[model samples]
Target: MEEVEIEPLGADEARDILAVAQDRRNGTRWSVALALGLRQCEALGLRWKYVDLKRGTIRVFWQIKHQRYRHGCKDPHACGERLHRYPCPKDCPKARRTSGRKHVCIKEGQKFCAPDCTKHAPSCPERVGGWTFVKPKGKSKRTVMIPPPLIPLLKQHQEAQQAERQAAGEAWQDYGLVWCHTDGRPIDAGQDWDEWKELLRLADVDKDARVHDARHTAATLLIEQGVDISVVQGILGHSQLTTTKRYTHITATLSNEAAARMGRALWG
Candidate 1:
């Protein structure tokens, strides 16, 4: 198979990004995304039951998607096709880039197919439903250990969420996600793009960075910390050892050190 070159931020950049997000609203969620190599969907799907604060572990067993919830937008700024929480802007064009099978462009708010742009357009799902959460690309599911610091932050978040729930009373939706809207609804992935880009811009990081890069960030950091490749493979739940190999981006010093270690092992 051809090699897949993964792009993770330099350690400094990653640290800066995490620092910037540390106190932000979705800070814990973003931290987990980088620390545990979770796909956005996996993070979205997380529930309280899956987390074990006492044990310092969390389960990764399901993904979340809010399907078929439609908002009928009106003209002048209309998404006439009923939408889920993340509806496309009325001005969204029919022709746009397809970022995986979700079809709707989170950055551009453009629907996968142009409005009546194709003969099969009527048959397309985006015309009726909303974006679907997918698994980590071409990989199976696996759990990874959480960083020690994040565990307490998670506990604090849960406490804060409980306070919010009490404040809202009957208004809280109780979807039980670790990452969710203030009212306990699923976060709209399409709507998050604007804020994500803005976060990157404010941090002086690449404004064009995709959120999926967090998975790459976690994987690369693991390799840098001297974790075994086979362990990373299991953490990432890759179908093949080679699939996990694609995520390893080593620094020159580390590469040189690896060579030296091998040489010592051979000569000494």
Candidate 2:
């Protein structure tokens, strides 16, 4: 495992990197992935179905697995770390009344009261009216609430995606997001990461920065801006507060600020 470090990128460097992706026409997904500290799989697994635009809430579920359905894995220790699927809720807000797929319907007030529903597997529909949530076997699950600063960008990106879909016209199959390769296929995680790093290099950033450091960057910024450590911990989805604290680096700027504050308090 790579040791985590507090590697801070200059704002100009960050901006340049983001611009490169935009210039290349790689959607905001890459930038958003960096901004939100989302894992590669989590970002790749992102779909229109999970995004709640009106409320500005993005559901952090679903995992793109390598092979086999991890939902049924019995390993108690390994299960939580494994990728799992996010089944559509019968009462999901995103669900719409589509004539095509019954499972895709988001009918309001209409309970999925079918005698046997396809969503609830194994058990007969007669026994269960509907599924409240998917029960994927996982214990090491991590979920982080996004910061307020990132919410507006998410909304803007959603609108941009809609515009792109409209422009695509008949060719639009609604890949739900623009993170995938040109063909709408899932990009290989490692290769995609390498490409992003190369983009960063072209933008004049240090070659040593890892894609995962963005999470650290977000948390570090919060701390430097005087946000409470506990709040940063919650936003970073760290199981322990110590993990969150590790990302924060007290810079010379902070030290100077503290000295100036003390001087004013003592002199003034």
**Local distance difference test values of all predictions, in order:** 0.69, 0.57
Give per-residue CA lDDT, model 1, range 152-254, as digits (tens). Answer: 9988888988887788889898778787777888787775656556667778886367777777877888888889999888776667897777665455546
Candidate number of the best lDDT: 1
lDDT of 1: 0.69
Instruction: Work out the TM-score per prediction.
Output: 0.69, 0.60
Cα error, residue 206 of model 2, in Å, equals 2.7
**Clashing pairs for predicted structure model 1, backbone only:** 71-83, 94-114
Residue 72 alpha-carbon offset, candidate 1, angstroms: 17
Candidate 2 local lDDT, 169-252, one digit each (tens): 776654454355443445566876788788877888865877676555555656767778887665555667777667554455
Task: Give the lowest summed-lDDT range of ten residues in model 2.
Answer: 128-137
Candidate 2 C-alpha error for residue 191, in Å: 2.7
